[model samples]
Target: MGSLRFISSPFSATIQDLGREALAYYAIPASGALDKKSLQLANKILGNPLHAPCIEFSFTPGKIEFESATTICLTGADMQFKVNDKIIKLNSIVGIKSGDILSGSWPKLNARCYLAVKAKLDLPNIYASYSSYPNAKIGYNSGANLKKGDQIHWKEIPLNVSLENIKVDDKPFCESIKIKKAPEYHLYSKDITDQLIANEFSIDSNSNRMGARLLEKIIGDKFPELKASVPVLPGFIQLTPSGTLIVILQDGHTTGGYPRIAYIPENELSAFNQNAPRKKFKFKLV
Candidate 1:
């Protein structure tokens, strides 16, 4: 098997696929790429399956080196990476040579980025997924984030694959998120529901794969008391006891005690992940 060595890891990086499908019964999160559309684009450029594993990085930029020649592409949240010390464009396929290094800083527009290679990262499988779920102790390295001196294993590929160069559209996703009322939507008072639709909410720094707390606080006595735990989907908006709005994300727990007031589709989660802290967006009920 061939491999690539990590010269220095990003602030937070890991190999992720589409995540586990049927393991939620065991409380395992479907911990896939935060930005699936971008991940798919990277894989498409390399002719790999849409769900093929790729590197997802957030915040700080870092570096990685190739011990073998291969084709690679960086999609989502422009990384502004450089191969061989020469700057290369994001969302474009590029070639790498043995001993070549790629490094860069974070993008100005988004937070999460995807790096797809021609070959898949050799990772352990959990319920038929390669996604890393550190909370559940599943997938690559017991669901650990990429760290310095890590070796990513891959199989050798033909020389022609590395010679291909292609460009792709890197347009942004919709700024307005479409959501529907959830099972507990009625728990919110008229004022609370009206505020959610009329006001623009920003992502807080506390946001992560598990969930995010909105900057807007909805406080009032009409709020429903805490309820029994129930299964909820990723992107479900739940109000906490503190009157804070918590929007669930890719790695959210299967069951939560909070009332789910709205549905933020899974497909739209990629768009949400691109939003930097304090980035504002409005929610429209469908």
Candidate 2:
């Protein structure tokens, strides 16, 4: 196996894959890449399996040095990626040789980016996945974000794969997200429901993978007490006591007492993944 050493790890770098599937039965959420479509495209370009491990960078970028030549792709946030001082374009595959350096910054348009290599990432799989779940302390490098000086191991490619041979589709990148009404939707009045769809809500500054808060016209006394620690999943829209709406994501808590008004359709998860603070989101009932 060849080693890819991280000379500089971005602020929130982590080894992310398609995450464990069966663990969800135990209430362990699948905390993989928030922008899964991007991750899949990157893998597709490299001819890697859809669930192959990749690097997820947040906020800042990092530097990686390959021990041998390898084919790689970058997707998701268009982070300012560069190889040895030369900027590389996004959504395409590139070949990196031994001694070459790969570095990048967070995308100006999105929050995170996905980096995929040709061969499988040589890491231990827990519960049938290489994805990292920080909350549960499971999978890859102590189940935490990648750090500076970490050496990423991977199976070496037999031959250098050229970017020209890689074919990446743009469909998932442009698809619209769909959301379904949750069980708690009946708790709100029709007026409140109409307001939710008609009005535009801004992404609050205080948001992350766990959930995103939306700033909207307040709705007081709406389901003041729905006290049950029921199951919650990605895209669950729960109302806070103060009437604020919180859209839960991949890393959201397993259960909560708040009333879940709706669930973002699986397709729309990517959009919410990159939603920037102050950006407006409009809901539509299907």
Candidate 3:
């Protein structure tokens, strides 16, 4: 077994896999990598299972040191990772040796980064997932976010295994995010609905894995609340009583009382998750 030690942790870091599924019946939140596609791509480069565990770094994963030889790949946000002053390209396998140091800064493009190591992380699974859900104290390090000086042990990949180095172009940022009419779409008038599609929205700074809060108040008038809290899922966009829009994400509540005005498509959820705070975009109704 080898280990990777965080010399200095990122703004927020967590060990995550694909997250728990079908456990909502128990009121459990499916807290997983916000950018699911990135997580899968990173693992793919390392020849690991698509749903293998990876370190999800937010803002910046300041510094990390390899305690032994291993292989790794990075995907998602362009954190501009480097080793010994050499830039390490994303989506490509990079070999790590003992005492090697890796570092990165705040991403210039997306909100998060995924690092996949060619090894099995020694973390206990909660509800059949290695994903972290800090709110409920489930996952790595007892559901605590990673911090500086933390060490993660793992079983290294065998030397005989062949590693492939792959490269993929970074996706361009699209200002228009696609959405579909929700169950409560009838609650609003044509004018209000038209205004929503016509106006642009900015992601709020307070947004997190739980939800992405849009800055615009498309619904200018107060609306009656839902009769009861309805079941919600990732991509469900809830219109608040105050006129704000909140898009439920991976860690969002399974139920909400706000009006479900529209929802992003399942395939586009990862793209929307990459939208950093203050980024502006329009809703492309489909």
Scored by lDDT, the top model is 3
Candidate models: Cα lDDT each: 0.81, 0.76, 0.85
Ranking by lDDT: 3, 1, 2
Q: How far is candidate 1 from the true structure (C-alpha RMSD, Å)?
A: 2.3
TM-score each candidate.
0.92, 0.89, 0.94
Residue-level lDDT tens digits of model 2 in 166-231: 565533332233567899888888877777787777778777667888877557554556766888
List the candidate 1 regions with Cα displacement exceeding 4 Å: 159-169
Compare the candidates by TM-score and give the number of the best one: 3
Q: What is the TM-score (0 to 1) of candidate 2? A: 0.89
Badly placed stretches (over 4 Å) of model 2 are: 159-177, 215-217
Please tell me which model should have the higher TM-score, number 2 or number 3: 3
